[model samples]
Target: MDILQELRYRGLIHQLTDEEGLTKKLSEEPVVLYAGFDPTADSLHIGHLLPILCLKRFQMAGHLPVALVGGGTGLIGDPSGRSTERSLNTSDVVEEWTDKLRGQLSQFLDFESTVNPARMANNYSWLGELNVITFLRDIGKNFSVNYMLAKDSVDSRLSNGISFTEFSYMILQAYDFFRMNSDINCSLQVGGSDQWGNITAGLELIGKSTGNKAFGLTMPLVIKSDGTKFGKTAGGAVWLDAEKTSPYQFYQFWINTDDNDVVTFLKYFTFLTREQIAELEEQVKLSPEKREAQRVLARVMTELVHGEDAALSAIKISEVLFSGNVETLSGREIEEAFKDVPSTELSGNEEIGLVDLLIAVKAAPSKRQARQDIESGAVSLNGIKVSDVEKVLQSSDRMEGRYIVIRRGKRNYYLAKFV
Candidate 1:
């Protein structure tokens, strides 16, 4: 399939301006395209997956993909998909967050190609220095207040009283596109459907000022079958950062996908070919109880984000904890597996007994509850059953002289840190 055809087949194309023209251009030659991410947080959550993956597809197709960091526009939050005005982050904090997001984004897209290599850009370098007077005379003249208010982003927030800072965000973002079109000959912009207004604004602004007809395309906002937003767990956004969400937790998220959702997610998240995904879908129909599709989706996605070794460790750790095979795992593997679970620090110098540690870590409600858990064999340490109510802790039992992994039943996990 051609580029647009392939994207459409995967259900990646939500909206496109002049699909035929853009498709012809894409098929003819390598087109420079871009997608922007606002540095609202230190690490991107799983919600940012589509655009980044789309960027990878473009790069793999032998086109230049520019990953634009919204260092300037982030100062004014995009009000398109929100109910309230955002609390403005300090410039210093935004700068630090932008650097963090830039680092995280780099891992997914290939940046080391000799031909049509991926490019990194920050709007701050250009938008930061453009003087107000000159900017108004040159760029602002093209965008009227009425035209700006016509945008959904500005219209939605009218009752909420959006600040001029946010109201002007579209214009500034448009300027970024105009600059890229001039400097890099970027002709296409891709973003999520929520960004349709801003993407089209950029396309319009570039065409008017530079007289170049740029194109805009967007992917659907990922939604669940129940109409909930994607990338959410009861715990919160499914983050890419290991610290925010454990690798084990991440693995389990996809593993437990609703069988109906698994088929679609594989196409959306994985690099699996259509034939391969088709096979998985048929496999799912043959044995829905087997959970084969979820297993594949979970493994491939985990490997993409955390690496092969980490994926293996996550699965092994899950088996040890869930299958009641704790005795099969070493203390080191247990610690590595539970690093991101909720944790507490115990008094290191003091000789803290098992019951005290359980209560201290809040694994059990109280001393009495801790003893019952141990007696019933509902508690395990380093994958070994701890039936003794008064077992003494030892340094050798602690991995790397700092922590112990505690499992309460199949799912609850905690870390006892002795600092």
Candidate 2:
């Protein structure tokens, strides 16, 4: 299938300018397309998956893809989706985030290929050197106040208020396309649905400046069936950076996909063929209890973002926790698995009885409840059911010589650390 057909099947095409013309252009020769990512944070989150994967899709179709880091535009945040104006970050901070984002973008596209290799560009390279007089005369003259005011991005922020710095973001992004066209002969720009206005603005700039037709395409903004935004949990956004969100947590996020959303997400996130997805869909309908679709989705996403090794480790940790076999988990796996569980620290190799440890870890309300839990076989230490309330836990019992995993009933877990 052609790139457009593939994108349409995946539901990745939300808005497109000149669909026929773009199809013709892409068919003629390898067209160079670009997408911009603003450094709003030090790391891109799961929300960025669609666009980055879109770039990969284009590259796989023998087209040259340019990943544009919005170093210049990031200094003035895009007002596309925000109700209020954004606070500007320091230049140093934005620069640092830009570098990090660039690195993350690199992982998805092949820059080492001999043919149609991916390219990277920073708007700051040109935008920073642009003088105010030239910007106003050459670029700013193309956008009239009325035209800029009518855009959804600018119109939505009119009541809440938007600064001149942010108001001029469209012009900066337009300049990015214009510059890319001039330098690399880029003819297409892709982004999220929220960026439709900015993408079209860049197309206009290219047409008016160089008398060339540039195309724009946007992917739909991900939304869940529950009406909540995608990639968000109680803690916060699921980040691509392992430091911000661990591989295990990231895998679990996908594994817990809602039944109504799993099939749709598989198309959007995974590179699996249509046949493969159809089989998974059939599995979902036949046996929803198995959660086969959710598991496949989680494995594909985890391996794509993190490496295969990390994905395997995440799966192992998940299985160990699910089976209540914490004793087999390594120290690092224990930490990753129980990072958010109730935990306490003990000094040195201080030994304690099972009942006292449960009380200290607050797994039980009091010593009486603790002993009752231990006596009834409702409490376990390192996966072993402790019926004896007097069972002593020492340094030797610590997993990896640091952690003691305590389980109450079937699922409640607590951790104690020996420091």
Highest lDDT among the candidates is held by which one? 2
lDDT tens digits, residues 299-418, model 1? 999999988987888888877766756546555566556666788987777777899889888899999999999999999886667898989888777756767778888778888878
> What tens-digit string does per-residue lDDT give for candidate 2 at 1-419?
49999999999999999899999999999999999999999999999989899999999999999999999999989999999888889999999999999999998999999999999999999999999999999999998899899999999999999999889999999899999999999999999998988888888888888898889999998999999999999889999999899999999999999999999999999999999999999999999999999999999999999999989999999998888888888888888888889989987557888888888889999989988888888987898888988788878988899898999999899999989
Report the number of clashing residue pairs per model.
0, 0
Q: How do the predictions measure up, each by TM-score?
A: 0.91, 0.98
Specify the highest-TM-score model's number. Answer: 2
Q: At residue 28, give the lDDT of candidate 2.
A: 91
